[model samples]
Target chain A: MEPILFTLFGAIAVGGALLVVTRKNPMSAALSLIMSLFAVAALFVLRQAHFLAAIQVIVYAGAVVVLFIFVIMLINVPENRLPIEKPTVYRLLGVVAAGLLMIEGGLASRNFSAPATAVGEVGSVEAVGHALFTDYLFAFEVTSVLLLAAVVGATVLAKKKI
Target chain B: MMGPSAYLILSGILFAIGAIGVVARKNALIILMSVELMLNGVNVAFVAVGSYMGDPTGGIFAFMVMTVAAAEAAVGLSILIAIYRLKETIDITELSVLKW
Candidate 1:
């Protein structure tokens, strides 16, 4: 049952992500991205990472996608250009790179074995908070600094008169 | 009885498709969406590995990735809006201002 659920959510997430890239309409693409994010959060739940799952939905599906849609609407991309074309060389290079990446990933997967422990404890928010403050305190502080930098940089870049 | 390998492979395939889309598409918005797809693919792999390894760290990393992705989307969209205001077009070909 667990495997089945995993497979189902995994398929949904991958399929939605593919749709997000393939869809021509920007709005449709954004919607597909939202679906993909939701599916990924579901996978996190299956993995017993409940805290991660909640953050995935709230941060990604709720906030990021909404911002994407807002920008899409604000820009109001004119439909004057039906389809944009890329160089054949670019397409070929993309294919080659993707193929190589998949091959490398597949080879790497063969060497990995499941860990001895079974992850039965749910990754609750409290647990994650405790872990972040205790074992991962330095990393957590660094991430906060990084986030602050991002906020400041974004503000500076978006400022009209600055 | 699908194993972790199956999930990993699926994630890899999805990531590949996203890479293709990013390179093949000429619309900047679409390309950004493709990048998001790639990020999602990575998140899927992270969760799968976390579960299989019996470690919650992977999931925590996945959340961090999501946070980064959100910031990326915000910054990217703001840049797109700035470009659209100046050039009035989102076509990648038209963005040859920096090309020397």
Candidate 2:
């Protein structure tokens, strides 16, 4: 059951990601990214990170994607108005560079071997919350400050006359 | 069940594809989306590693990452909007004010 779920959702996630990069239409690409994010959330569930799964849905699928759609709609770039690139050598070089990156990353991951240590299960809401409030408390509080700064920065950037 | 390495490899592919999107695409919005893709890819690997080690740290780190991603999206979109208001376009190539 777990294996099947993994295969199905993994395929969906990767396929949706592929669609996201390939689609010319920003709206369509955004929708595909949303789908991909949902599938990744499923992967998180399979990993027993139930709280992360929920947060993934709420934060990414709900908020981030909506923000993207809002901007895409707000700007309203028609299909023909999308950026057009000349068939220059740089485009080919970019593709080659990315392909090399993929290869390097794949090889590195394949080489990573960790000893299988069996221990108590983690990732439940209670366990994660304990970790967050205890060992991670300082970082958690700092994140709040970072978020506040981000909010202020965004507001200032969006303002016309600052 | 698949090993953690399989998940890592999938994540690597996802990240790489996102890199392709970022490097190859012209639209800044798509580029930002690709950046999100790259973040997601890393998130998978982090969760997989945490699960393998029976630790909640991976999930905690992922939470931090999500928070950062949201903050980045907010700031990035606002900047994109300001750019659009000025040049009437969000093409990264067009906004080469920093290009030497």
Please report, in order, the local distance difference test score of every candidate based on alpha carbons.
Answer: 0.79, 0.89
Candidate 1 deviant stretches above 4 angstroms: none
Cα lDDT tens digits, model 2, A1-162, are 878998899999999999998888899999999999999999999989999999999999999999999999999987888998566676687678877987887777776765577735577899899999999999999999999999999999999864
Candidate 1 per-residue lDDT over residues B1-100, each given as its tens digit? 3467877887898799899889888889889888888887898788778777766677667767876887788778878877777778888888998999
Interface RMSD, per-candidate values to 1 decimal: 2.0, 1.6
lDDT of model 2 at residue A78? Answer: 77
- Cα error, residue A83 of model 1, in Å, equals 5.2
Candidate 1 lDDT over residue span A1-162, tens digit each: 878887788788878877876677888989988888788788778767788888888888788889888888887876665355636788788889899989998998887777666555637777677767887778878777777877877777677644
Query: How many clashes show up in model 2?
Result: 0
| Clash pairs detected, candidate 2 | none
> List-wise, what DockQ does each model earn?
0.61, 0.73
Candidate 2 regions with alpha-carbon error over 4 angstroms: A85-87
